[model samples]
Target: MVQENNNKGNQISRRSFLTTGATAAAGFMIVPRHVLGGKGYTAPSDRLRVAGIGVGGKGESDIAEFAKGPADIVVLCDVHDSRAANSVKRFPKAKYYKDYREMLDKEHKNIDAVSVSTPDHNHAVQAMAAMQLGKHVYVQKPLTHDIYEARKLTEAAKKYKVVTQMGNQGASGDGVRQLMEWYNAGLIGDVHTVYCWTNRPVWPQGIPWPTEKAEVPKDLDWNLWLGTAPQKDYVNKLVPFNWRGWWDYGTGALGDMGCHIVEPPFRVLGLGYPTSAEASVGSVYVDEFKQGYFPDSCPPSSHVIMNFQGKSGDIKLHWMDGGIQPARPEELGPNERMGDGGNGAIFIGTKGKMMCGTYGMYPSLLPSSRNKEVNVAKTIARVPEGHYVQWVNACIAGYGKKELSAPFEIAGPLTETILMGNLAIRSYDVRKPKASGNGFDYPGRYIKLLWDGPNMKITNFEDANQFVKRNYRDGFTLGA
Candidate 1:
């Protein structure tokens, strides 16, 4: 049976309802019928009433995956109606809204969960708002644009006692589990260094913003699309995908693919916050003699090294993007592909090395012959239904009832670790007028940034802290 709100006609505000729920012994006024009926009895209201925040592109796919499970996509929201057309068509019964805030505010009581697949900048605010209303949330990867936002969302998940998951589906895959088993069996013993690389930024980067402004599409709510980002005129072609190149809306390649590529090592090694970070960015030459550094844009490429003090020992992880790759390992054949040709990860351990592609797929230990020789008992349960279904099942199972593969508790730290590379990339461009007045002095260059993981600050460089937590534009805030 569908869970009925005990306070039917009272129409209590979402905040009041949540507060009452917290103080109540049951912890929730609307208990699922299954809980009352005991095990083996499926409730008619067991179907999760899901609301999607950005139903376009990846958002469309995310919603579709949820819909495949015992979920009803009741509300579909997107800043650009044109971008959301596909999802709207798929779920004709779903109520449509251009603004997520309005959708969440009006539908908070009706919806069971929210799936946030919006731009990086808007992720934290939307997810936090839903969590505040006591709704479970599944946010897309690179969980938030900034480290502080990632940290806040992580804390909010626990505070609200909501089932949370980040969109890095690889966390739910069997490949990561296979790798974990291999590592646990002492096949790849004590990984000391790791390399993750991606050939991204296929979108334009290392360039200035377009000078020409374009008229906003009639179907697109430009301001709503901007969300917490500073108000700016809509630029042509920035909406669909190219925004990944900019610092304001997207997090460049690191944020784009880091979650997928870095997740394996994090999961396998039980990694945590890094102690220090440093980076070198590739520059785009504007002229024969001069190179340009666009502060508003991410560099064309970058190589970041982060040092994590693990329980076993210190780990040095290298991140390379924009076609940069590490040297070929001697164990693999000369013709063997390194990192699935474009994006992949390599783990160097005391015993051997293993590599995998994005989403932890195609895991293979060094020396292909070892694959047949190694056989270890599977210790980790596999999410065969996949990442989205795992989250949906967990949400239905209620908070603290079932284990999630990429719960915010795990994804948040992974996101923070991924974004720390971006901090180094942005800091690498910090410059001031030189004392001689001939050229600018890049003070951020050639310095290792010491980090206080618990505090979320760069102890060595004060200026770098600005990127740790961005200032939300007027009206939007990461409310406590």
Candidate 2:
């Protein structure tokens, strides 16, 4: 038989549980029902109770992976009911909520961990809220939209003593370990330059917003979906995937694929923050005769150059998106793929070069013969169960008990480095009216923006500082 709390007079509502001290002083223990055998005791369970914030698209896959591990999907929340339908069906016993705030307020005590897979803009606030309640969090790639948010989350993870992992699964793969081993063994002697390229933004970009407002889907909560962004009418095709091309919601190609493609070089080189950054974006042609720039949307393509100070020396990393790729190495055969064909990263060092594809797959030395001749002992341990299982186990083991590959301490700086490239991209669009009143003068072009990483600011270009931290809409904040 299970014990029950019969003290109705002392019972406190879930909303007031975290705030009220009376419940604690009155000798009322807020233990889960399963652990009611005694006070200050926890029932040993192999499962971790998890609540998913964005249960659709990548969120759906994230939850699915967690379910395969030691997690029990207890609650599902999404602004769009239709988008969350599959996850709800997969975990029918889980309660559902449209708003994350309501779910956290009522279910915080019940949930042991949270998986945040929402848009880039809302990630920080939602993850912060969960961390504030002492819940472990696994947020998707490009941890936060702004640099300041990344810094805050990194600090909070330590302050709150909660386990955290970013959803850049490549960090857990064996390929990266191989690269690290090769680097450590001096196969590629002191890397000085790197190139990471991606062919993303398959959706619409460099276009004007829809002129007409569309009716909000009956099953969708528009306000909740636009959590931190300014209120705007719902637009067709933006809900599920197309949001990546907009500055208001996504971090463009860099945010979408940077973590997967850049993680290898960042990890192998042991980089901190970028010291300077610059970029050149592809222009959009409105017609056969006229070219224009869209400040609200990400350009169709871009090439960002960021400099990082490494222990060996200064490292220069070039990021190319929208199908742009670096020149092929002359030592390779003509038929050999430059980096898994379309998306990959290359490291240029003093002695030789090495490259790999997205997710750190297919790492190889410059010449095909060198890869076969060189074999370095593995120095880094591989995550056998992969990234998702790694996080689930880490959360269960408690903070500081298990090592996470992409903890906020690591992922935060990686995300900040990736987003720093976007600052240069956005700054390239800063314009002022021309003196002759004919066109606009672009002041941000042809200038390298010096970065002060610790302070999260652009020292050379003051206009670029606006993007370091964004002003959140009312009712949403990076919680303290």
Candidate 3:
């Protein structure tokens, strides 16, 4: 039987953790490392060739970090040339493309890996196509635009047997590893609930649809940006970075940051599919448009509660965006801060708690209990340092895969946790409400979403489930 972890430590002690790193510094045990399956798998003598799709914003960072590592970036692909210019500058040796498909067909063999940092909607398509070409993939999170997409990507990675990683960089952080170790050592017992929040909703909130059509920018190929998304006229509000708040291109605040913020310990603790999901949100066109711009793509803000009936008990994940936070856990240090602009997660265990700021595994909090100290497992060690180096070393020397800090298999579900939030948020725009009064299910809501991991289909709520799955513009496979 699964036992839940309570925050009541039997004993207390004062100890300052001193470690070289989590993977392997001084004392921690390092898991066995192996190159990708296949006998003749020789390390790359030529810089592992790369191509980057959706080459702007976070994509730039993804490219820069890899190029900065022991790799040679050979191709840059983005729908908008102007947005991709800086990335092109970083990889002067690489060719550029507005259409990623053409880039793949032409440079397929020449490329060993591809970084997919496109909007949520394009991630599954780009990453899956790259993997089918026998290329390694690094796609940004929420791994896919929706839940079924996440499952599809997972299956593709497994079948293709390519080394894959998600772009939730927190998966590579020092504190993230440490948090995992604490869980592995049974510090938090069997954790049943997690509360994660982010301060988003700045770009796309309660604002209404654009009053005028936005002319396509000179350098951008608008058709490509709408990849697989239903056709729509280009609007400035939908371009560059503001796409997160839209339905066709993004998954609102939850989809925007869930991959980074909610994923830290969820990955560490192994939070599989959530059983039941319900929401209470304030959207972009909500309340007749009060807060911000109401882009058709996203909601204003939401406070969603999901209950997953795990083997142990019910694990409730509380998610909020738009300047909201659960009351700070009793375990936080006095120095820790909360409020607007802070983007991170707080893992409230049965006894003590762990908290993180914008950086995922960074700025983590420990208790400052004078009366009683929170006890952690003596064998639990700190996380390995340099999340960036971890992935680099793993890719180059083939050292980190067996225990990839944030392998796509794990992070996908965590990102899906956020996708559920998208469902909750977007439900506000449901032509027919899910509930009749006060956001409760309609007098007799017929939809019962039963998510089976490997299958990824809702046994009940057939129509509602399909709505959650969404229809892609032709040519987009839901992965497997």
Candidate 4:
């Protein structure tokens, strides 16, 4: 299924300018707007070429989205051979490779865009490489593993002048659009607080420590799976999907779901950065917590709180999961059901309220009065039709914000918000003594997220703030 055709897009200077040698985040000395497409990068249309990394699970669906109309899936990439094969089967017209970096270099000018659906740890690395090549990027959500990376990805996309979209499809969906529209329209007067959660325990939660290394599957690439993370023997329990719960690969539950859960609030409120953040958990434990590594000071089942000093008011947005919810009202919709693993959110305003669960605020609005579900906002066309399509279309028709929603500017913060949960987990452990001992511990811990955009620090508490920017093993500093 390998393609042999040449690509068509011109090698326009990626965004405003950066010589392709700039390494750190803000190392270049120039006014950003002037140097980095002071306005925005011009996009290419007519004929678009695309590739996909991490071509398993959700990656499969992403392939189809990119292949719609005038777009060709040229290269398939993944850490595992099996995953890559699956992607190739879906797009029998594309070639396959295990290392995305190799594919980018070999394919060079052939790939115009790349879909990055790798593990949370690899998103930035893979996506950043694609951007450096002047290829547009579409990365899956929880866009970054940490706060700094979120900003780094944004800066890279602008530097490369590529069209980009975080995998948070809901950002442009019908329900979320209403969640914010209602707030903006004053339907939910003076929003004060928001609570959201996802019921995700299948990925090794509620289980004891993994003392034994899982027999690495031959089909799996153990080394690739652990990219950038400290080396360790492969464990089936943490491979593929379960990694999300672990401190190493996935971003824990919050990292897994927060970008979607907390997004409505971030957008509706026009939130800047968290003022402070604190997390509490129930019996947190890790095989081993390393400094500079994830789980630095957090438990596995950590509940993180990100507090933002809103322009109009102060609010505390709570996160929870694992057989828990924000307290369901006695009633639910007729077949308008909420999965037993209740994942959703509820907003508390000065008057009445509004709530949406699991798939980004769908069910019952609050007050029951105005809570009636109508296509209050624009309809969200499901996957092959909705989010993914929107991103591709927008990129093709330059200046398509409404089309390619969740661009870097918006996605950067969304990813930063979710990473708080991951970092918070890094700040707790089941056997270790309490961290930031302000009486905050697993089962009943609270760290408020304080946003300090100027400093790029969380300013919640010195102990917690230090965690926001973890020590990268070495040579992996946030490419500045």
Best by TM-score: 1
Worst 10 residues of 2 by lDDT: 1-10
- Please write out the lDDT profile of model 3 over residues 90-114, one tens digit for every residue: 7788898888789988988677778
TM-score of candidate 3 versus the correct structure, residues matched by position: 0.79
lDDT of each residue in 1-480, candidate 4, tens digit only: 111212222232223223554432336443343454545533232346788888888888887766765567888888787766767777787887877767987986677778988888778888887777667789998887777888888877666566788887777666766676677666667767778777765566544435687688787777767776777777655656777665556676777777777777787678776766676565544345512222322233556677878877988888886655666544444454443246777787876577775546474565454555534554334343566777666555443233466889888877776776655544533444556332333321344445576567655444555545545444343443
- lDDT order of candidates, best first? 1, 2, 4, 3
RMSD per prediction, one decimal?
A: 5.1, 6.3, 11.4, 9.4
- Candidate 3: what lDDT? 0.65
Model 2 TM-score relative to the real fold: 0.90
| Per-residue lDDT of model 2, residues 246-320, tens digit only | 999999999999999999999999999999998888887777756767777888999999999999999999999
Q: Give the Å error, residue 388, model 4.
A: 0.9
What's the lDDT for candidate 4? Answer: 0.65
Full-model lDDT for every candidate: 0.86, 0.86, 0.65, 0.65
Clashing pairs in 1: 1-44
User: CA lDDT of 403 in candidate 3?
Assistant: 52
When 3 and 4 are scored with TM-score, the better candidate is 3
Per-model TM values vs. the true structure: 0.91, 0.90, 0.79, 0.78
Scored against the true structure, residue 140 in model 1 reaches a CA lDDT of 96
